[model samples]
Target: MATSISFVGLSCFLLSLCLVCSLKEGYAFEELIESYAESYLTHTFEVSSLFASSICNHSTKANERESTFRVVDKYGPCFQPSLHRSVVPPSLTDIIRSDRARIYSIQARLSKNSGRRDLIVEPNSLGIPIIDGSAFDTLSYLVKVGLGTPKKDLSLILDTGSRLTWTQCEPCRSCYKQSEPLYDRDDSNSYVTIPRNDPVCEYVRRPVDPPRPINLCSYEISYGDGSVSVGFFSKETLTMSAAEKINSFLFGCGTDNKGPFNLVAGILGLNQEDASIVFQTAQKYNKIFSYCLPSSTSSTGHLTFGSQTPAPAGIKYTKLVAEKSPFYGLDLIGIGLGGTKLNIPESIFTTPGTIIDSGAVFSYLPPVAYMTFRDKFRVAMSAYPLIPGPTAAIETCYDFSKSTSVTVPEISFFFKDGTIVGIPGKYSFIEYNTTLTCLGFQDGGDKHSIIGNKVQRTMEVVYDVPGQRVGFAPNGCS
Candidate 1:
């Protein structure tokens, strides 16, 4: 059996040896060291600290509606009740493939000639823990919520850009394997299928679709990466926590679901759509929500609904471009490296606009903007030797095995109205191995850019729909 090595507690010599055994099997240690020295020098401290606190244990205790629950990385050491008892942890290839698929889906979805629409709703509050799914083969966040009358726990991907909330349901024609059991409408007294004629079904209705049975409200959502979820558009009681529940919550019970969901039950859409949980209970929560994404996969963060949990003090506000409906849009103007602004033109960002998304793992910039940022970053890292990236999407990689100390330039984002959000070294670069670290930003093509969750880690992100503004606060998650 091949032994897995974690750099956190291992000695440097052991780590160097393990690199050859684990990452480059059959390679001699001396040969590996010679090749490494000729190309790069890396260290273990920063990389080790990244995984230092990632262990998670499941708790049977019920949490208060207003209180937060534990969050874990789906592929980290802490994710409990492994998806498959004997399945080995996903390899790097799997993670890169899944992440690329997700990125393609997002870019393809946004490239379509889609219009933006807004809905009005009221507000209230509730709290739930959010899991980071960046480790292994997934690059999204997960949330644990209850579905139906008796409430069966389901882990769903939390996506701010998605409009419809959904989960795999019973009688699956085609469904991916999930840790939680498929939701059974027969078992839930609160399950209520919406009528085809009901106005609610019109939101997702296709223009070329023929008429269907009045009682059958069907819905289908497809992604660019060929993932699709099709099933009934229904309503049910959504249990937010032990103390809070939302009645007549609109959601999709996916009967034919297939995709790279990473074994999670379904997706919890948090966009501004009428069918979204944000709007469904808008009156109760006031359309205000906030979340703090933990910096490391081993750490925990939260997703809070309403004003019950106050926004962190000294929070900075930025305008949410109202035109970019269904997405929390922001006017990203510039980028700074080592406290020095890049020479890229501001129009490079303003032309296509940008949206902050929780589902995307890495931030993406326009080609010109990304090139400028990458070039500046490379210059700053000139002391370190460049190496091939672990994935196609990530082009800038460094080998740092020889250095005892490293100095990473601070990267910051400049938004409209001069809101400068600093990106911590950990959030800006992902340590793929003790020998390799890559910048987190990617090339988003010429279309609209995206600010993924990696850069948002450890910061409190407040989405105030009614207020038409987004806020950021640093160190909100400890």
Candidate 2:
């Protein structure tokens, strides 16, 4: 009996020893994998042309002297303090839905067969009002600027797709809650209302049965998601900074406004149009503007107008199809991932062509192109374990909680003029949280491919409107 008891104890001791050894070995193996991931990512960023440009240099921060406004992510910590207490921020799912809605709205607007009735159309002006609820909400970037003589600071959405720069004004019939006080034209000495006979008045879309406010030039703009702004088009002293101010700047003062406009005061129109600040201040800035969208909400980015906008070394230029005026269009020839160039045909991109929008959060490719790109991405990321994303819209996701670092392949956009815009792994995949990350690209459908802000991160996007070309350079901001 004693010998049997002793034997059992010996067996238990041996089992415990084995378990301890296995745990230690497992921890050591985990450490090894983590070390490899870090080294691989460092090497990839160092060697890959997509990240090798001056823009990728961490040493270079955003230049404040020439920058018109410091761009901040709307949902980021830096901008959160400015939001109204009653305002509720959208969730990740809400953001994805709004983004898709915006893309579909763009497709509808561009479609010739679509029976959507027009709202506001300015024939002589750059004031083609784009109506989509997602238009304002999905715009993740905001810039602070002053609109009146006394210089009341206002936070406005910085959008390239939009034309009519507008803000909520006093004597509001209906107004949504905003971070700042509404602009009162009565308070500003520089405020000038447009007359009915002015050339700019032609830009205001006339309703079937016009409701003209006598001598005042009134405009009505609506979004698909049930957001609308109706107000008078007028000119005021536009103040960018203390050193920068433009007299007789054309903009909309929304007396009646309602929408999911978040906490923003208004929109900063950067489109190719007479009403856009780009064209309005053309002589001073030469219709050339460049901006760097921040990679994260905690960080800061820059938006610079005119010749002062920095064009760092290794900047690539691509032809802009200005025929799609309100939207900045470019020819997307092909796409490449890692060592392999994607098998998608050029016709896929050229059908409706591609437009790069600053308002959007995710890039949308055609079905075939998106699938091929997604499949290739999956294969390249096969080493990492697959995981479910926060939303169904984002299909490609990975679990990196166990690992200290993540290694992803480089995604490159090949343009018609051989201007290759290389997207680094960090920019290619969005880290939803510490544990999960998702591919930044989405299927935009057959109509048109839209390049959203996600892939444009870290690079300085230069829109040379007069030059009729768009340029991409590295290391524009932090």
Local error of candidate 2 at 475, Å? 1.5
- Candidate 2 per-residue lDDT, tens place, 1-478, comes to 9999999999999988887787677975677788766444321332122212212222134445543788877766556444335433454555567776667666666666543335332111111123442333453787888888887788888888767788999988789888778899899988998886899977655334333475778777665565667888889998877778899988988888877676788888888767788988888999988888876666667788885533566788899987666789998978887634688889999987999888777788989999999998898788788887787788888776666555677778898987887777778866555556678888887867888887888788989887889988876785
Against the true structure, candidate 2 reaches a TM-score of: 0.81
TM-score of 1: 0.79
Off by over 4 Å in 1: 1-45, 52-54, 57-71, 83-112, 116-137, 206-214, 401-405
- Which 10 residues in a row give candidate 1 its minimum summed lDDT? 120-129
What is the C-alpha RMSD, rounded to one decimal, of candidate 1? 14.9
Candidate 1 lDDT by residue in tens digits, 249-358: 88988887766565678777888878888888788988887777766655656777886444477788888998777778899999887666789899999998898888
Best by lDDT: 2
